[model samples]
Target: MRKRFVMLTSASAGALMLALAAPAMAAPEADTIVTFDVTAGSLDITAPAGPVDLGDGAPGSTITNQLGVVAVSDTRGGATSVWDATVYSTAFTNGALTIPVGAVSYWSGDSLPGSETGGGTFTPGQPTTDDQVPLTGTAITAIPAFSHSGGTGGSTASWNPTLVVRVPITAQLGTYTGTVTHQVA
Candidate 1:
């Protein structure tokens, strides 16, 4: 699976790059080139932070649901795989990045991240909304927790989706971001 990163900043773009180019009056430029060893890490997907009760209707029709995978499993057998995917929104502030209460579906309260469902050739790490895939983008990454076999041992494969939600920009400002977290449970 291929991986890509997208960071949207109100700044001219590439906020990090501009910060590095800015002058530091108290510092002097040196003709020395320095190199250091570093470690890299993948983006973290925290758990959905909180819940936004969609609320009830005037006649008192209540609406209560949190966004999460409906289920994770196979066609014939396997442990039900579950993912604690979180969705949140952030806004740029002179004060630093901030997190805000995100919007949920009017009905499902599911964050409007994204979803795709159906049968087709899958490209791991190739981002898609196939709701039929696993919570993780890579098929190999998502394993069947439990499995069953006939006395003769013949089990079919199963598929689900890697449900996703985009963090809303309207989210509040803070050092971190959060949103309503709920499970299909």
Candidate 2:
């Protein structure tokens, strides 16, 4: 009986050692989904700070001046992003002496040196002096963001425009003031 009891105890001890030596069974893994969100940005435009000054001219003569730098910045990111910049003007009047809006011509020359940044294509509304369009109280495109080759980035474009005014052959002479407005979308 003593011998049998010793053999049974030895077998139990061997089984316990084997169990401790082997790796434990792994628990089932649980998965947690991860996620995030990104919001859209904004598009904006900056016009030159000025009351643009077109120098003096005699009656029936044409007066000209530079409207300074006009800029458009697009923060809205997309591969095919686009926008347009339009310009409008208020008639120039100096107490009874007036310059009609139709007499004002705008020439958006080109993007200034190093003024165009980011990625995309910028098209000037008036590429040259000959392309100048008259202001008739209606908004005309000053610049157009036609295409974007970049993957998902913003773009900017800026240009200096020339304003030409035709002084009517009337008999009044005074300093004329007018408002030129620029808008973008």
lDDT of 2 by residue, 1-185 (tens): 99999999999999999999999888799788999866667888778767767789989999888988888777776665577777888889998878888888988787888877775567778888888888757565333312224435678778888999988888378888888888877
**Candidate 1 stretches greater than 4 Å from native:** 1-31, 57-185
lDDT tens digits, residue span 140-175, model 1: 333222122222211122222232233344544333
Clash count, predicted structure 2: 0
Q: Largest lDDT belongs to which candidate?
A: 2
**RMSD, candidate 1, Å:** 29.5
Task: Give Cα distance to truth, residue 19, candidate 2, Å.
Answer: 22
Best model number under TM-score: 2
RMSD of candidate 2 to the true fold? 5.2
TM-scores, one per candidate: 0.19, 0.72
- Estimate every model's Cα lDDT from 0 to 1: 0.29, 0.77
